[model samples]
Target: MFQETVQVLERLLRSPSQIAKHCAADEDPRALFLASLCATLLGAAAFGGVLATSRGGLQLLYSATKVPLALVITLVLVVPALHGLAASLGQPLRLSAVVSLVLAATGRAALVLLALSPVVWLALDRGIGYHSSVLLAAACYALAGLSALGLLWHGVGKSLRGAFVIACFGLVLVPTGAQTAWLLRPFIGRPAQARVPFLRHRESSFADAMYLSALSSQGIYRAPEPNSHPAPRGATNLADDAEEAP
Candidate 1:
């Protein structure tokens, strides 16, 4: 099993074209899903470990749930929406092919995250601020995700009109994942309240929160001035909603 897992991962990383071709050739979708699951779990575990470094052990536990939740939520919305869109356009696709494509993309993302674990750990250990660290980690994930999406487009073929579908899918998946992450707060640090709340009332929209954070000097939002820098590296400002970002 271990050997097979290693070989699958190697193919994913080293020769994605081969995997795509294999899938195109009608490889078993279950095997692809299983391999993707293993890859994603390993990546999530690495991320959880990094979270454990700064956040408490409890955070490590919470972090474990994030990826699976995000994946499930995004898929639930994306799969149906995409199928509907494809159908409306008179281009119905195989569910199995779509499933295999998404899993392949996710598996690639997981591997990418696993590779980034070390850098994240180092940045956290070096005392990067909570907000900065989280954003950086997210950026890493975003890059990985975009790469995976690119692979999806390439592997699935342009004739499938994958680019359009992926764009629509991304529009739904990204924000849903973000909001879901927001709901499952404090994965990166201690909560402001003494007790952890499962679902806090959303005071502001995600866009507003982002806008406000950008307007402020604290969050990812930055002004046009080149001289203006973000919060000091490694600054801990837990007073700000630590739960804002994933």
Candidate 2:
């Protein structure tokens, strides 16, 4: 069995096109379409929960705003990773810094559009507190800008560009995962919230964690729920919500 597996692996790696074709056999176009739909529903649920209370909005605003902040934060975290990746791909170490910075700037611009536009629309539609809206708006813009930076880097950072792109995505995904964990922790019956530095306050209490999780009457939180409720006024919950291109 082991020898057979090794032989298959060797053959797969030798022909990239063959590997692609083989994997494509597992592709489910209909499932992908349905999954996309399901993703939209999930996002809407998350948005709806954020809209429930001013406190929740404030918390979400604080968190979502970190998207841009993460760009800067992750850049610091990701630079070394990107540098190494670039070098592996045959890029010059000497020029990596300039390339990384330029890419970051472009990503930031895209982030602003993704995060701020919906924030503005929501503030108008829901009559969110002005101070809250502005604060959220500013944070949203920051995220959009950073995402814009990432998109730029993805396109322009050539050698090890794939690695650079992966790193940027990691920068976005890491914080997102962290934030989701923070929000979900409280609702999962944890008794306390752990504070993370540099973004905003952590849940501070287990009960304070993701309110929507607690709010769910169903075992799981579904945006539209099976019963079907409207999503938040402005958020579609897509990456486009907070990670659009410039």
Candidate 3:
């Protein structure tokens, strides 16, 4: 089982086409599914834990658990949309095939994240600022997302229609995945925060937070209004503190 799982992870990076083909046509996909799922869980958990190293403590566990949970939940929620988009784009696939393809793609992305974990840890250890670190993490996610999209593109046929299907699927995927991660925020707790929280109070959408972060990265900060209620003690603007620690 361990060897098979390792092979699945290798193929995900080295031979995405072979994985795509297996997902599409294998008579018995149980092995493939199990291997990919294991890869997804392990890879995401490792990356998540590394992300928490900046703030350290119980936050490590919180980020590790929440990251995989966010990815799995995002996968579950978006698979049906992917299926419908594929069919609408004139490339219908069996539901099981779609599931396998999506799982494999996610596993591929998770592996990319795992590969990036060390870099993230080293950057934090070197004393990168909080907002800069947030941008760095976003960049890592972009790379991992591209890896996942490559496999999905192959699964859908690597043509104009396939591109359309994947593009539409991405429209569903990016927002859903971001919001899911947003809801499960604080993967990297703030350095100044005294307590870790399992979840943060809802503030703004993921897009808004990211926008604020981008502006903040450019040295533009949103000043608090005099009449506005003060944010909670540990809570800081998404741009200023990124995600609060749990």
**lDDT per residue, candidate 3, 1-246, as tens digits?**
778777777888999999999989956777778877887899889988998898899999999999888889988998899889998889999899999999999888888989999999999999987888888888888788888999999998999999989988888888888888888888988778899999876655677677778788788988533333244544345565354221
Q: Each model's TM-score?
A: 0.78, 0.35, 0.92
Model 3 clash pairs are 189-245, 196-246, 197-246
Alpha-carbon RMSD, each predicted model: 6.6, 18.6, 2.8
Question: Which candidate, 1 or 3, would have the higher lDDT against the true structure?
Answer: 3
- lDDT, candidate 2, 6-28, per-residue tens: 44334322432332233234442
User: Which portions of model 2 show Cα errors greater than 4 Å?
Assistant: 1-53, 56-69, 93-103, 106-115, 118-246
Superior by TM-score: candidate 1 or candidate 3? 3
Q: After aligning candidate 2 to the native by TM-score, how far in Å is the CA of 165 from where it should be?
A: 5.0
Tell me, by TM-score, which candidate is best.
3
* lDDT minimum window of 10 residues, candidate 2: 237-246
Which residues of candidate 3, in runs, are more than 4 Å off?
Answer: 224-238, 244-246
Write the number of the candidate with greater TM-score, choosing between 2 and 3.
3
TM-score: the better of candidates 1 and 2: 1
lDDT against the true structure, per candidate, is: 0.63, 0.36, 0.82
Off by over 4 Å in 1: 86-91, 159-161, 191-203, 215-239, 242-246
